[model samples]
Target: MDRHYQNLVQKLEEITHLNGVMSTLGWDQEVMMPAGASEARAKQIAALAGVIHERMTDPALGDCLNELKEKNFDHLNEVERCNIREALHSYELETKVPKRLVQELAELGSRGQGIWVIARQENKFSDFAPVLKRFLELKTEWAQRISPELKPYDANIDLFERGTTMDMITPIFECLKQELIPLIEAIQSQPLQPDTSFLQGRFALDKQEALARAISQDIGFNIAQGRIDVSVHPFCGGSHPTDVRITTRYKDSDFIESLYSVIHETGHALYEQGRPHELGDVPASESLTMGIHESQSLFWERMVAQSKPFCSHYFDTIRAAFPENLKSADVDSFYRAINTCKPDLIRVEADEVTYPLHVILRYEIEKGLFEGSMRVDDLPEIWNESMQKYLGIKPPSDTLGVLQDSHWSGGAFGYFPSYTLGAMYACQFYNTLLREQPDTKKNIASGNFAPIKVWLNEKIHRQGRLYTPQELVQRVTGEALNPDHFIGYLKTKYGEIYQLG
Candidate 1:
């Protein structure tokens, strides 16, 4: 039994290494690879996907799993048992999907992402529609193959967030929509709004980059272990804990966009860097889910960076970096500007109060696409209509509308929900953090994020996939996943900002 377990671990480690290589290649494609390399890169990704699929579905792994389960399952330690269980779950699912489909999807995703960049630049959805359609079709087919009993969309949702489904997410989104629409309407009706005009102007790209790098490190994203780069959309990806890579794009007109993106991606990098180092290339050391992963990013971006305490601590440094832009801005106004509640065209740049509505719109559209109620050709119109209906704003171009996000081009269906789910999870975890450490805000105000990072690492990061997201939430917060905590948080924070009585 021990021999079987060792062999299984060895195979799993090899797979993990291969997956890491794939991630590195993906990072290169997005950040470093030239436009002409798209075709070759797609083929490379396809071949690697085929190899990974073969290894994942290997019969030797199945044999090891079976022997361990039958012979010494009861004798295995908790970590060992967890690894075995997750490996088996993945093996079973991977075996059901064909290698051909896996390769096709991988290739399409690689090619589509490059095309998406070009199409977005040109503001033409028509150029990317065919790839988008084929990617969706392949993903739907892949989902059906793996989970025949589930609705195709539900199966895709499970790919990113295990155990989550439309039935589970719909009610939460509906609750948010019900509560948020009136709040937004009220805020919009206010006679006075923060003058964020100071945030808009020419700022040197090098200065912005320097400021972002300094702030990310100050917040505990280790510069020695990770790096920051430029990409069309900001993201954090790396081969391992010690090699994390994060990227953020700069806008000379607005430093806030680049700065917040760095903060958000740093949140992700910190989680990657904080995973238990001893448990290398194993399931137990992996992130629990996309929702959990998103929670880490949002926790910093919204719960910390957007807070008054953070603004108070960091305003001087920021103003010093861009003296002309922020010379007249005080901490209070800076906090309000960062937390401004307004509808926006870009989902990534949307204010917190209106952000979830953007996600909900994407969720609805994804649901519609998989359910056969929507089509690729209809996306721009549908997106525009939904934006108007939800936020009382309509996008004038496809780039700002359907093409704003890179998720679909990369075959990331059912991923948008993770953002909102993560926001809720972050709130729950943060509320617990505050309860345990009453000085959390003070710590932020003093620019001492060590306590916050240490707490998160101890409570969330090191555990890895040792617990399901639901179980982890319960263990950390002493309650089930609840939307009320998130809703209450929004009301309390934004109410004070908008003076809603």
Candidate 2:
């Protein structure tokens, strides 16, 4: 191996280690940190962010990368080339922004999250607006500094889903709206709706946790390497694959929320655990993008868990866990109940057909905010208006309305589009999986998920950042991202469930 390349790898590994530490702190803040420690945690996170920024923007690292790029460029293997390319990309972006801004963003993110939590619980966006406004301002400035050529919002979107822009996403979303709105309207107009009354009753939290954990393990989340906990909002986060942490909130009245949150997050953990273990602490070993990461989660959540076969396989276990609540329920009713389509205030709890609309609503509001057409003060009204426009319903309060998500609190301005994009990717990937395997549903129904897990590991997870999201999608599915796959998936599944034809 080249000496300069070796030097670059060592430095990159150190940065990755520091990043893992930051992630650990973040996980603790959400899952285990006391309420009183918010201020200190913010400072700690900020100081570490400054250090990571310094390491990322180090002059020595740049010199090494330049040497590798200009001199040893063609001599390196594909993996080495990929590492150098990704490293240079990060170096260029980080060097463009000041370390002070990075620390401020980090501190603000930590502080803003705590504030947002209080505001959300209080059902008041007012308490969170000031910090949200500041976070947005910093993020817009950060976007401009990193990618001056693009619009601030575009740059933000690119930060999460590389090479994606508003122009590209708008049409896909429009297509979804075009198809989904009418489909939802048709479903609503149907005389008979699925009997979902059984899904809304008090269930034991302990039993819910046990059932979620058992299903999580059955579906391939290695509990020995990872653990699940409770959080205000569910997420998959940890310092490394071997120590992954997943969290989901539980409501005693609704086990569905926590159970599926575990399923969704378990998808993410599987990806992390399946990454190229030998590539330790380098960009090439990281998941490609937020879109791809979300794809893995949605793949399991929507494509696997929400499917009829999955419901058939797991319904008995679910009923056994809550026999009193589900005593009269059968697998068919359970499937239809869980798959019921309706407008909802909470994005996390939304049905599959209505979920993307929630994402699109946020995407539009985010664009408006960055484009200066909207202010933080206008969020509640605008959120309500968009909700009504998109889903034909309005959130009665700010908590269920503008303050529902944790993304904006943490300066994740452009992350909304990834959820919908990931849905499309998930559908495309699953279509390919079904075509190849031809018995995936049968296997799933029989509680045999090894083939599916092994396939995903080989096809998506193990590849890591070896390919871009676009490249990975094409390599696995044999085409570009076609929103039609998602639209088609929704239409086919819902059509059957609703008798829409």
Candidate 3:
């Protein structure tokens, strides 16, 4: 490698480590920090982000990039060229924003996350609106810096999934809305359903914790390298890939709440753990996008964890975790409860069949937020109206509704579509996996995830940011990202449960 390339790589690696520290602090704020530490955490995060941004956008980095480009004016080696090109791309993007604006965005995001938690707990949007306004205000400024050519909303989207614009997402949303509403309506009309009462009761918190750990381990999350904990919101976050940590809220009345959530986050953690060893310091090792990452989690959570095969293998272990509480809860009932299709207020626990609709609703609101078409102050009314139109049930309050997610408060406007994108990718990936490994479900029934993990590591996890999300999808499925595979999988799997038209 050229001297310029080496220097740029070192700079990026140093930045990566600094960013990792901020990530650890942020993770603690969300999962383990004391309630009063938000103030200190916000300052620390903003300061670090400011320093990182300044360094990334430094004129010296641009000079180094120019030097490297000049060196390769004739021809370029693939690896050396990719490294310089990636670094230069990052520097150009970072330089687009002023350092002070980046700091403000970070500060607003951190404070907003804290405020959002309080609003969620209190079931009030008024408490969170101020923070949301500040964050989104800065978010608009940030979006302008990234891609002045696109609409502000489209620019924000490219942050999460590179190359994706609001225009691209609109059709994806349209396709889903066109097909999913009728499917949800059909499921609503069906009489058949699981006995979800089995999931609820006065189960002990200790039992929930124990079960969470066991399920994480059973699903191939390394007990030595990773741990599961509880938080207000269920999520997976950690400082390092080796030290992956995840959290899920437990409802004493509902076992599936914690159980399936663990599996979901575990999916994310496992992907982090399994990223290619050689690409550790390269962007290639980083996750491609929020949506692509979500598919890995959902693939394991829904396609595998909730599958009949997985339940058949682990029902005894599950029963053992809460034997006293579920002595009479048959394995079949627990399985059915998990797979039951229903429209629910909570997005996290919404049945897989109805989950896409929740994402679509969020996408609509988020697009409006960015395009200046939707006012932050009017969010509650818009949120409720959209929910009613989509799910036939509207939130009576903001907490269970507009204030439910932690994303927007933290300036993640373009992130929601990824969940549905992920679901579609998950379904498609699962189909491709099964086509090659026909007995994949049977192996899950027997609790052997090694083959599946190995398959994914080879095909998906190892590629990382080396390829864009669409490229990765095509590489894995031999075609571009498609919803038909997702819709087909959903129908084929849930068809047995909801018996679709």
Tens digit of per-residue lDDT, candidate 3, span 1-501: 467777877777777788878878878887889989888988998999998997788788888888887774446544455567678788888988898888888888888888888889898899888887777778777777777788777877787777887778889888878877887788778887667665667777788788778778876788787768778888888766777889898877887788789989999998988876465475656777898899999999998988888888888877777777667777677777788877898899898878988988888887777767989889999989988898899888888899989887778888888898899899889989999999898888888889999898889887767777887889889999888887877767767776666
- Per-residue lDDT of candidate 1, residues 3-90 (tens digit): 9889988999999999999999999998999889999999999999999999999998999899887875678887899999999899
**Model 3 Cα shift for residue 298 (angstroms):** 0.5
Per-candidate clashes, comma-separated:
0, 0, 1
Pick the lDDT winner.
1
lDDT of 2: 0.92
TM-score of each: 0.99, 0.99, 0.96
TM-score of 1: 0.99
Model 3 stretches astray by more than 4 angstroms: 73-79
Score residue 147 of candidate 3 by CA lDDT.
74
lDDT to native, each model? 0.93, 0.92, 0.82
